[model samples]
Structures are given as structure tokens and as C-alpha cells.
Target: MSNLQAKIKTDSWINATWSEYIQITENSDYQKAKFYYNKGKFRIEMSPLGNDHASDHNIITYAINLYAVVKGINLNGKDNCTYRKTGYQDAQPDLSYYIEDTVDAVPYGTSIISLDEFSPPTLVVEIANSSLADDKGEKKNLYEDLQVKEYWIIDVNKLEIIAFAIENEGSHRIRESQVLPKLEIALLEEAIRKTRQTNHSKVGLWLLEQFQK
Candidate 1:
């Protein structure tokens, strides 16, 4: 096994230098992992492949896109995209959105988004199945530091969304999204609950009706 794999465990934070983190992430073994680096610590999340995790992730993405489209809000949605502040921080959120005027902030050919050159996404989301506590705690603080306008954690087991509006290096829990303009956290939770009883196609149709009304 490689030294990186020997010294570090996946799905948990490990103390490492920024350069070591980069090297481990670039190694082929972690090609599909989600990565986070903050405050001299880095976490390599082995991508969750369970059906429950993926189902919730798909529905949330569908709901957001459906809401944005029906509401005529211009947006660019990114799935598992990387955002970096060079040596300072790096995050690969499960889902993120650049909304309204910032929809085009990231140009077409950009690779890992450089936070120093561009503004952070208006919204960031993490789909939590096994990493719920980390998502709600350390990851939440990391997003605040990155100045993400809004952060959300979707708990797959509970079919719930805990959202926060972030500002001035702090955050407060919010029911209605400030970034997405009146998008209701409870509504999304309801949609996720519906998915437990039906397929995503039917849940998506339900979301369409809700967004239209």
C-alpha cells in the first residue's frame, strides 16, 4: 500500500500538510473520493455508493433544478465540483449552485475553482448518510470560512434538510433559503419523504406541481 493510504484513513480527518493532502488526493486510489482540507487537517471521504445515499442526492439535485427552472431563476449547478483556496482550503461539495448574477462567475474552461479569483457559490450542499455529524459541525464551519452564502446538509436517514445562511464568518439556521429566495427547507424534506414511498420520477412530478404553484 502507498504511504498515503497507510498513514491516513478514509472518511475521517487526518493531520497533514497541504502538499501531502494534494499528493494523496491526486493518487489514483482516491479518484472517486470527496476531499476536504481545512486548518491543517484533511478528510478523504470514500464516495458513498449505497442506494439510499444516491437516491437522496439525485432527488435533491432534481428538486433544486426544477425549482430554479420553474421560478425562472438562472443558475449553474455543479455536482461534486472542487473549490480551492490554494494552500488555505479545499472542498468538494456534493452539490453547489451559482445563482442569478453569479451564474457565469466560473468560466467554461475552469478546472478546480480558485476562490481567490472568483466568489464562492451562492449555495452549497452535502448529502449526509454516514458523515452527518462531521457535515453539521466541522464542514459547516469550513463553509462559513469559505464565505458560502448558504449551506445545507441533507440527512438521508431522516429525509431532512438542515440549512443555514452564512455571513460575516458565522451562520444561523434558516427555514427558507436566502440565496434561493423563498425555497422552503420543509418542502424539500417533504419531497424526500415522498421518495421513500415512490420513485424519483413521481417525486419529481410532485416537485413540479409545488414549484409551479
Candidate 2:
């Protein structure tokens, strides 16, 4: 209906192979749902979906807000930042955080930052339901390759959180506890549960207390 939406709609009509799509639109944002070449001939590539009901976006936002508030940590909530140069791929992590000290590393007031410009977040969280494979597979590889310090996969269906920490270059090892020792994993879990029950300010307060403690 709007110009931006119209442009996205138009781009969706162009039929291009994954390699061709990435090669042609390497520098620009071509928003559409299509498949791309990875290890095989093709892999389904698109923006993270936000369906009308039970969208991952809402769940991710809620979790991030809770985490930030409970931990009293400064974070930037960026969505749909294109992290790759070659591929019809763009990832909108449910929520991403750049900690207090590293805030100035990235330019301010920008929603989209190039993957090469700044170091990866202390933590990157992906709320998974249907796109679990992509989050755990291709995107997991992407973030690991980018050298993100930590990554979290939150499964809404199962209400479980799995975290991965990078050990060596391009290697991710699963973590069983909060890397930030001051913050309790149980508190985070409780906040997540509260978010699912009701979007409340208490989650934020709980996070702040953890930071202060």
C-alpha cells in the first residue's frame, strides 16, 4: 500500500537464482522470499517471518525487554540487519544486544549496520518455532563465522532456552549457564515466563535488580 511496501512487492516478482540474486543485489536491499545456494543447489532464503498470530517478533521483543530490564544492561534492539554480502539472505534476530561498553562502537541512530563495521553483540537471540532449522543451521553458521560472542535460541513451543558460545574461530559451544555471572538464569527464565503470561513492567524491574546486585 505504501511506497516502501510497493517496492518490496515489486522486488518479489523478479525471478533470480540465489547466486544471481546475491550477486546482483549485493549492495542493495532486495526484500522477498526466495531460495539461495548454500552447500547445495538451493536453500530457502527470506526475512524472518512475522505472521499475524503468534509471531516470533513479538516473543523475541518481549524476551529482550525483559532481559535488558532485569540485567540493567544497555542494549540496542535492531531488526532486519543484512549480515551477508552474497546471498538472498537478511536476518532479523528476535532481539540483539550491544552491551554498555560497546555501545559507542556502532554508529548511533541507525537501524541497519553492516556486519563488517562493528564487532558482534555479547549475545544474539533467535526465538524459534517454525524457522528453527534456519536459525540453528545457516544463521547459526553465519553468526559463528562473524564471531559473535554468544548466541541464544529460544524455543517458544517448548519454552526452553539453549545458548551457544564461540570457543575458537568459527566454533560454537553450547553453554549451560549465563555467561554474565551476575545475572541468574532462573531470573531470566522467570522473566520469559512472565512475558508469555503478560507483557509487564516487572520483568524490566527484575532485570534492573540483577544489574544492581
Candidate 3:
């Protein structure tokens, strides 16, 4: 392994100081990679996203926005937004949101949201294609520690959503969103499944019908 890879392995968590983690992430070599840090270890996900990953990412983004709009819930969605808790923890979740009363929690012009200044996002989501295990394991723990109100893992292979409602630095499985109110986990899973058999517009129309009820 090169000096960099020796210090930090890609796709797996490794023990490192916060300074070491920052050095690795700042290097130009990993500009496009996703980074996560928690409890003195960090993960570098360098795997290039494939077609399946991209498709699911877009569809889920659409479904959440559509639902929020139809339900008249004030929402702000973040795509691959880096959230940092200074020397302690960091995450760039696939998707995140500030809902209703907290829609403007991070304010405009903020970069690499500082948890010291702003509360962690009310909801965080990771679309898990090849990284299902890590997303379910270490990453889930990371979000729990961050104290996000909700966390979701979309398993592309299974076309399923595994969601949790977080509190008191812990989490438990939940079928409906506590932050977004009546949004159901199974409904989102159904939307993902429909995307496999039809185009997004058709599925979107179906969602509109469902959300309108």
C-alpha cells in the first residue's frame, strides 16, 4: 500500500486521528470520494457509482420532494452535503433534510455544516447499493451518535427501505417517519419498486395519486 492507503483504507473504517482524517480527505486524490468519520475512525468510499446506484438515488430524491410538496410540509433537501462536527464526527449522506420548523436550520451560504453552530439534520438517508453492510452497520451508528431525528437506508438490490427514528443518541426501526409525520416507509419502498418496471414519470403520477389521498 502507498503511504496514503496504508494510513487509510478505502470502503472500510480504519483507526486514525481527526487530523489524519482531515489530511486524507483534503488530498486531491479523493476529491470525488465520500468521507465519514466517527469515534476516532473514518471511512473513505471510493467506489464509482454504477447505473443502479444513480437511478435509485434520483428516484428517492424525487419521491421525498414530491411528498413534501404535496403534503405542504416545508422541506429542504441536501444531496451529498458534508456535515461536520469539528474534530469528532463527519458525514456526507446521500440525502438529508431539514423539515417543517427546522427547514432553515443550516441557513443559506453555509458550507460543510458545523454541528456546533447548527443542529444535525432532522433526517438523513443513505442509498445502499454495494455499501449495504457498512451503511447498515457503522454508518447507522454514526448517525445515531450525530443525533439526527431519522435515518434511512435504501437497499437498491432489495428495493427496500430500512428506516429508523432516532432519539437519546439511539435509534429504533419505524414504519412511518416521525419527522415528516405521515410519510410511510413502505410507500417509499413501493415507489422504488415501481421505478424498476416503469419510468419515473409513471411512478411519480402514481405517487401523486397516493399522496393526494
* Candidate number with greatest TM-score: 3
lDDT of 1 by residue, 116-195 (tens): 99999999999998999999998998999999999999999888999999999999999999878889999999999999
Off by over 4 Å in 3: 1-5
Clashing pairs in 2: 69-207, 69-208, 70-206, 70-207, 70-208, 71-207
Residue-level lDDT of model 3, residues 42-109, one tens digit each, is 99999988988999999889989999999899999999999999999999999999998889888788
Candidate 2 C-alpha RMSD relative to the actual structure: 6.7
> Between the candidate structures 2 and 3, which one is better when assessed by TM-score?
3
Assess every candidate by TM-score: 0.96, 0.63, 0.96
lDDT of 2 by residue, 100-200 (tens): 66755577665555555566666677767666676677767766656667787776666666678765756544544344435444555565676665654
Better of 1 and 2 by TM-score: 1
User: Which residues of candidate 1, in runs, are more than 4 Å off?
Assistant: 1-5
Which candidate order results from sorting by TM-score in descending order? 3, 1, 2
Ranking by lDDT: 1, 3, 2
